[model samples]
Target: MRRRRAAGGSGAGRGLRRWAAAAALVALLAGCAPREGVEEIHYRLKWLYNVSTVGDLYALEKGHFARAGLRVNVKPGGPERDALKELELGHAQFGVASADQVLRAAAKGAPLVVLAQIFQVNPLQWIYRPDKSPFREPADLRGRTVGVTFGGNDETILRALLARHGIAESELRLFSVRYDYTPFYEGRVHFWPLYINAQAPIIGERLEKAGEPIAFLDPHRWGVRFVANSVITTREMLRQHPRTVSRFLAALLEAWREALDPANEEAAVQVLLAADRETPEAIVRRQLPVTRRLMVPEPPAAFGRIDEAAWRETEEILRLQGLIERPVDVRSLFAGNLP
Candidate 1:
């Protein structure tokens, strides 16, 4: 009986040791595995996929968000989609919006916060044949036919420009602009509003091919700094998921810096082409350098620096134009200390 008991005890002890070893091995494997708290976030863009969103698309394609343990769903915005509204309804955790949009929303009591200013210089500009327009000064705009999208930000900018230069609306013929560029092509309109990076390359290339010399009248050169697209989130999101916001921004801005780097031009172009198959590769190549110039014109200027002055100017423009009912303290809308 003692022998039998000893044998059973020894078998039981070996079985327990094996179980312990197996448990330890499982734990060891788990410890070495990738961390498991991956967050799923929805990010909405102000516009469709193009050179404008190259950095955004690059971040997703290159696994920047994945490396940061985030699963981001990047949704493109159009005329029907409003990023500010998406943020308000919890449809998106992060979104891109223009300064004017942000200000208008804040004026109407939206809890929005600006994460980063994407474009250091606004892309909206007037394209014209310098030979025909001879737009040497704002005064040159007087007695000329200019195209303006009546209710769009272009009108706001044009109004502000004329206001700044003391050029009244009656001084210039404000031609209503639409999707068709026939007026500009036929020289009926002296200056046409087109995004310098998006539409300029296509239109300018066509004009250049036709032996027409083109020049862009930059409002920034005349000191009309209406802020463009910017990364935005709700005040609640910033407060609740500060870490996630920081990580997302860090990943995004890192991707932007890399995407804008001339060294990575081919790779960035590939990314943009993959998302925007409609745009010809040649045009994207042309568009990218212009985008890089607008976003990071000076090498020393930070890519996502929030231009407070620009924001204030944007708000003041909105206020003076009666786009917003009252003043919105622009400073309250920015998350200046971004990671």
Candidate 2:
């Protein structure tokens, strides 16, 4: 009886050892699995994949977010897609939106927060033939036909520009502009509104190849500081996941700095090409430098640095234009004190 009991004990001990080893092996395999500690979040862009979103694409392609233990779903924005709405619907945690959009949403009681200002200078500018227009100042715009998308931000910006220069809308013809560049191409419109960083390269190349001298009329040069695209999130997201916000912004801004660096020009171009196959490589290359200049024109003006004065001007512009029903306190819109 004693021998039988000893054999049973040995078998039980072996069974216990085998069970422990199997559990340890399972734990080791789980540790090796991907996304164990990483948090996944969605980020919606203000526009489609283009030179404007180079840094965002670069961050994802270069593993910046992953290294920071974040799995980001970088989604594109377009005419049909509204990033702010996505945030409110809980479909996205972070998003990019123009200041006017933010102000309008805030006026409607959207609990949005601006995390960072992406473009130091607004990329929206008027492109024209320098030889034909000879625009030396805003006054030069008088007696000329200027193209503006009536219901779009360009019109608001154009009106603000005219107001700043004491030029009335009646002074120049406001040609209704659509996607077609026929009016501008045929010289029917003297100045056309297009994003300097995105559309300028393609259109400028076309004009230059045809021996036309081109120039850009910058609103920033004229002191119309209507703010542009910015990074945003909901107040609840900021409150609930402050650490994630910090990590995401840090990774994103760092990626922007690297993407805009002259040393990484080729890499940035490649990243843009990967995301935007429709844009030819040459045009993308051309677009990148302009984008860099718009986002970071010089030192002491850091990328993603919020210009509070610009925000105030943007809000005031929206209110005066009646785009928003009421004034949104621009100060309350920023999540500037994030840890």
lDDT of 2 by residue, 199-307 (tens): 9999999998899999999999998998889999876666656777788999999999999999999999889888999999988888888888888846677789899
Model 1's lDDT to the true fold?
0.84
Judge candidate 2 at residue 13 and give its lDDT: 56
By lDDT, the best candidate is 1
C-alpha lDDT of all candidate models, in order: 0.84, 0.83
TM-score of 1: 0.87
Question: Residue 331 error for model 1, in Å?
Answer: 1.3
**Tens-place lDDT digits, model 1, residues 1-339:** 101112334554554454344334323432443553225677999998999999999999999999887889988889988777666555677899989888876666666778888999999999999998898889999999999998798999999999999998898999999999999999999999999999999999999999999999899999999999999886656665667778899999999999999999999999998899899999999999999988984657678988899989999998887777568888888786433
Q: Candidate 2 regions off by >4 Å?
A: 1-38, 337-339
